[model samples]
Target: MQQSAVPELAHTHARPIHWVATATAVAGVIALSSVAQPGSATAAQAAPGTEAKSAPAAAAPPSTTGVTFPLDCGPVKAIVVKKATGDLDGDGRPETVAVVHCDAPMGTPPDGVYVLTRGADNPKPRVVATLVDPKDRRTVTDFALRARTVTATLLGYSTADVPSCCPDLKIPTTWRWNGTAFVRSTTATAHSV
Candidate 1:
């Protein structure tokens, strides 16, 4: 008996090919492909019983799309207050920075700085962002908003024995608006208060 070389060659060369076809009334027939390009019409077309809804364009975040404020700011209480007006958003319009004495815990007296922008929808200004004392060890003794930089004076103690009623050490810090929020940009040493 002669070994059959022809039969073995035919079996080795022959392979099955699989194809899938999906049909939809609106999108017509589509053949599935492994490598599909993004944003292509065929890629976006819905399959079979499904319908495609167009995606909406991306909207800018509130912090980027600066709003004008005369917003209903609700209720706010402050003892020591100061206001600064300038173009903090880089826009031509002026933005108001309100530095107010905020309610704090028994040991700490913190001051809050509020950034408000004007809006046409309401006469009141809209509050955009607020910055309070960053650390818990001390209270905000004094603060000033100038040229977009918020400078604050912090009063604390160098030794544990010092009384919390009146802090002996004074630390000065500076925070600047970097588009999104006020970040502490500069740090200074403590001095006698």
Candidate 2:
């Protein structure tokens, strides 16, 4: 069954980030926009050495796994979180919504996103997916997230380099978050959706 997306940012998933408006992703070399020290999804573990988020955690965090490290992006460089939401699981728990960025100065590299999620058992933050702007047909931005329940951007990015499948069909795809895993929704087969 499909439900309202966790973020509630954009109801539809057909809209993409308007990079031109902000002139944000200027195709520059990737760099560390911000460093988010890891946190324990569980309430038991106190954040002693973890990096602090701009926002404080309310109540208890969900269990989480560790994020993938040393992520290779062919030519992509440092992957960083651009934007994120707090709750996603709908258990009165906050899920993470991260906007990953890549590309920077010379030798910096291209850009990509590193999404993380909190699990119930592990308690450590887990890398959900690393998204890259699909600038080519052979290569498209594929999201890899923990899958607890995710809501992707609806706007077709002006410069995100849309893959053949995304634009051709031009629809929305829902990812179902099972307690233990995530499953792609098959309700709409709009080729793009």
Candidate 3:
């Protein structure tokens, strides 16, 4: 995957979102793949032999189209808040982090992460913070959020391609979401461990 040139995403965050196609916003049109659609429910309960009006129920096919989205970079993440810490900004004070993580959506387009942290000035309610990946995998080892300050480790963004959605073309580049739109961040080979 390649890195995107868009800098706005330098301090943004990314999230894994599932877009379901209804009449409005649909993740994508899912076709038959391994998982088969189920039969429709009979409407004979309410009225004797009334034809069912709803569409046939289909089995949720296994997530096939694995999306390849880029994430975790400079300005790419506005701020990463760690749970368990009572404060965000330093100075023996409590802070509320408000970020616009809109880039969390899937795809090479740079997404944004909108985060909001709130606390009080007097006898504030200390909220614990815990950050993790889509797989619920723990990332931040341990840290504290002080007033106007936040500390954490680097983010390792992974692809969310199911191959089942857009099988013909699985994005080969690292796509990023910069708050409002998608941007190619960088190629997977650009950086190394």
Candidate 4:
């Protein structure tokens, strides 16, 4: 009598599948490790004593110009945000954006978006605007300056009404220079992991 061979054939086929899955997993880990490494350009240059500088150089800043902030918000204990510079006002000069974070009560420090411009005397690097308030619950997660537009990514309180350790929502907002000030051009929100 001839016995069924299906069981033997299935076992042989499953072995190759298992090997393939293991090989794929190993390849994925290698790729992730490469990305996890530091210093691959596109990093953020934070000022001394600021944690923001730790972020990878997120593309070369639009000409440092050696400009400095006029108003010292405080010691930059942490850099919650770092945005590249771009010619926002069409003045042929790039404007930089930085949102600094310092230690304070309620995990809500006096963090503000400092828009820096490299021009003028007395205060060569004067702040164009300081957008911050004591009542805001959103924190700057990331930012990018491109084509005279500044896009800020913010993490805000979740639907549970509690300020969790991690952001539950991501809000991407765009601002454009309207000859005088940066105006909101677009905005959208999504659930963050």
Which candidate wins on lDDT?
4
Positional deviation of residue 28's Cα in model 3 after best superposition, in angstroms: 94
- List TM-scores for all candidates, in order: 0.45, 0.36, 0.20, 0.50
Model 2 deviation from native, Cα RMSD in Å: 26.9
Q: Write the per-residue lDDT of candidate 4 for residues 67-104, one digit (tens) a residue.
A: 44433445444443455766678865566777665545
Candidate 4: lDDT over CA atoms?
0.62
Residue 127, candidate 2: alpha-carbon lDDT = 62
- Compared with the true structure, what per-residue lDDT tens digits does model 3 show for residues 1-193? 9877976662254433322224224323344332466777884565767765876553221111221222344445322332232223232433332211224334332222222233343232322222223332212322333433343332333334433223222112222224443343334442212
TM match of model 3 to true structure: 0.20
Better of 1 and 3 by lDDT: 1
Give the winner by TM-score.
4
Report the alpha-carbon TM-score of model 4 versus the true structure.
Answer: 0.50
Report lDDT per candidate. Answer: 0.57, 0.44, 0.31, 0.62
Ranking by lDDT: 4, 1, 2, 3
Evaluate model 1: give its TM-score.
0.45
**Model 2: how far is 68 from its true place, Å?**
4.7
Residue runs of model 4 more than 4 Å from their true location after superposition: 1-81, 103-111, 131-135, 158-160, 188-193
- Please rank every candidate by TM-score, starting with the best: 4, 1, 2, 3
